[model samples]
Target: MSITARLLRYFAFFWILFLCAGTIYQYINFKHDTYFIHLKQTAVATGWYLPAFYCHIFGSSIILLAGFFQFSKTVYNNRPLHKALGKLYVFGVLFFAAPGAYVMTLFINRGGFVFASFFIQNTLWVIFTLSAFLLVKNGKIDAHVKMMHRSYALAFGAVMLRFYIWLFMRLGIGVDFENNYIIISFLSWVPNLILVELINRYNKCPYRTLQN
Candidate 1:
């Protein structure tokens, strides 16, 4: 990779790691009250919420870091390692992250709009991830790569969700907390998927590998 490309890749990798680390830190003590301040009522009301929350948190963090390396030429060339990480990423999303997100969607206290946003996003994440796994199994490498890109885009929404929440708070956008959250619920994943689609289109040339 060119120096610029390498720098950008490392930047993104570390940025994702930083976000994941910060999120994991919040739950380091495994206390139900740590990040569940607002969801305490829901947690008490539903027996499944805490389990789903932990699954999504830890599972998504592992997949986010693993998925980043999926695009690396070095990793891609190492078939055993690539397949191992691919399985990790796929299973992480399908069995843990996506399922957990689906369960959590049921408990979203935000209005229907926010709930719908998360439901759809989570649905797409599962579909894209499953499709990628199936495609690779069938030896459809090119299509598999494309679908994996889409899957990872949705996965990155976790980080984007937090970043947007922080940004909105800093910029004083959508001053109402409920309204702000509603906006962020959609903002989190839509733009990431759109950007991924644009990148896929721009790099459609057969000679252009995803690693580039």
Candidate 2:
């Protein structure tokens, strides 16, 4: 790895670990506290909050770490671990995270605009993930890798969403809660995709071709 690639790898590793820690904290809160806030809301509305929340929290957290390692050429060269993690990542997203996201999208506040944004994000997330899986199944390794990068970028929205929320609150750019959420809903994953594009364009890394 070049100096820049090494630095990027370290940054990605620690950033993902940080997100995993945050997610695990949420899991602990739900597991121990019964997620009383959500339970109360669910009592008022049949949202199935616990299942959906747990699915997204756990599934996404697990996938963040799994997917981070996936970018390492070392791991990708190790066929057994690479394939194992790839299957786990796909299964987690397909069965748990994406489904949970779609279900939870029904409960987003601030009305239709926010709902549409999240709905689109969740839908594309699933589509990209499925494409990645299908590409790999058909032996299109380069395409599969590109698609997986795209899918994982969207998945990282959980972290980027929180960051945007915090940053905007600090700056008082859009302090209105509903409006803030509205911005972050689309803001979260869009920058991630753009970043992925820029990295692919500039880095010109062999394994990082954008053949679609």
Candidate 3:
């Protein structure tokens, strides 16, 4: 493989591993932590919270796990399974995951900026997914693919959040971690979309092409 390809492969592997491990750690810790349990219980006391939590957790997990697969060019070219998975992914994000994220955002403790960042992310996530679905429905495959890529890039914030924390902690900066999280809430995805924009530019792929 070329050096760039090799670097990308290594990055992808490490990213996927770190994401899986960190999320598992967080979930396990959440299960044992009295604070999280109490918060969950409180959320459950309200009728919408429990369902939102479940959808957010399960749907996000599934999206993260399945998202990497969608990036494979080979899989995109494969008609049957690809379309089926794409439909399922869109449904999961739109009907369950994104809505759940919006509902859960009301309870975020990172104060206004962080909550607003996530609220925006959730909104954009739904828009990206819906746009991708509409493109495919209209037989615009390239637009569908690019839009779905943007959608998955937003979903990758969960992975990037932990990655940034690890970076700051390892750097031994004395800054307050909570403040760092506030920054990361937005930083995690803004650069992602920028990277996507660069890719589209380099590839000369218009966001939505019309070939009349």
lDDT against the true structure, per candidate, is 0.83, 0.79, 0.75
- Which 10 consecutive residues of model 1 have the lowest summed lDDT? 203-212
Of models 1 and 2, which has the larger lDDT? 1
Give, for candidate 2, the lowest lDDT window spanning 10 residues.
203-212
Maximum-TM-score candidate? 1
lDDT of 2 by residue, 9-87 (tens): 7866776788789778756655535453544484326748667867888998898888888887789777789889999
* TM-score against native, each model: 0.89, 0.84, 0.82
Q: Report the C-alpha lDDT of model 3 over 1-212, residue by residue, as the tens digit.
A: 47996797678658867666655666644453545547666665677776787677667777776767766666656667677677778888988888888888887776898898999888989999999888888878777778887898898876776677678778885326657778877888898889887775577553233321
lDDT of 1 at 107: 83
Where does model 3 exceed 4 Å of error? 21-47, 174-178, 204-212
Ranking by lDDT: 1, 2, 3
Candidate 2 residues lying further than 4 Å off, grouped into runs, are 1-8, 29-47, 172-178, 200-205, 208-212
Q: Pick the candidate with the highest lDDT.
A: 1
Query: What is candidate 1's lDDT per residue for 1-212, written digit by digit as tens?
Result: 68987896776787798888987898867776664545466555678887888899899999999999888778987778988999999999999998888888888777899999999999999989999888777767778888888999999899888778778878878435657788888888998899889878888624233331
